[model samples]
Target: MSRARSDPDRKLRKAKGRTASSARWLERQLNDPYVKQAKADGYRSRAAYKLIELDERFGVLKRASRVVDLGIAPGGWSQVVRKLRPKAAIVGIDLLETEPIEGVTIFQMDFMADEAPAALSQALDGDPDLVLSDMAANTVGHKQTDHLRTMGLVEAAAWFAIETLAPGGAFVAKVLAGGTDADLLGLLKKHFRAVKHAKPPASRKGSSEWYVVAQDFKGRE
Candidate 1:
């Protein structure tokens, strides 16, 4: 049975200042097929495939005209959207400046800032048909704390999506392994016709991350 997967374990030579954990991570990245494929495909990061897979399954990007990309740093998700829907009017926000991508309006500031949602909406100049947030709080190693913090970001993104999406729009965001908390799930269920969770194949099996897709926005009534 083990012969079904033939790639041998790859180890790295011990190097100064590289911790064992860091070495393992580096080694894994070096050997990962998706990492290599990302480079070959000219993708900024492997996370691009996660969105692609999700869209393939859920039809999220099919007719999106106006889109908002939250936490779009290296711009992988935005890149995918740009490719699949070339005419999409994309506006992305990040605390870190992203290099220019054609036809995308980028805001280099914290999405948690008081002015963020309006800025994104204003830039789009229309309700978004797709709102995407790959935002996750920085981990501090405390499992409960990390989950709570990330959930806070997801909740905020959800509210932003609800407020800014056009009728029949969709919202997709990254959430932790156990999925959206009860209250957040309730909120999504009320606002969208379909609320589903998925862990795309590109997501590391060991990672505690998944995506919550809320589709068919019920309008602002």
Candidate 2:
């Protein structure tokens, strides 16, 4: 494994009235080995390692011809795709602005919009072999509300994958720790030959995020 971040010896000077949560987050970012590795590897965010780790276990990127990325801000996932599958037709959409990634078609549009699916499909020029979503809703501090909101994004992403993925394609999305809800799990099971959950080592141990991988699409009826 690559070297761990510098011993956590560096300290941030206390700022006036900084919240404990913010301070802890800052410290974690500074000391995270993945953050340092990402910088060395020229990845835009540490989240890149999460994708790398997942791909290692799940073989999500190999031989993909057309791919769609939802919630692609910071564009690390797209970067991984570009490097691993250089010839793959790649399109990504996000609500926030993402700087241009060479060879990736990006739209600064909401993936939840009615026109988003059609736009993505038209851009790719063919059914996607891999549909990826890393979207999570903004938290409002209430656990139930937060879960519901994020899961809603997951559900929407699942529907898009079901409708757009080519036969024998795959869908992968970020989900919370309890894994996908019953209804969503049922939908994926009906369409894919394998459905599994994975939590990569790059994910923080305390983080509730887990990923659901649905593979071998059965094609639309």
Q: Which candidate tops TM-score?
A: 2
Ten-residue region with minimum lDDT total, candidate 1: 1-10
Off by over 4 Å in 1: 1-7
Q: Please write out the lDDT profile of model 2 over residues 111-173, one tens digit for every residue.
A: 889999999999999999999999999999999999999999999999999999999999999
| Per-residue C-alpha lDDT of model 1 across residues 121-155, encoded as one tens digit per residue | 99998999999999989989999999999999999
lDDT of the candidates, in the order given = 0.92, 0.93
What's every prediction's RMSD, in angstroms?
3.0, 1.2
TM-score of each model, in listed order: 0.95, 0.96
Extract clashing residue pairs from model 2.
none
lDDT of 2 at 157: 97
- By TM-score, how accurate is candidate 2? 0.96
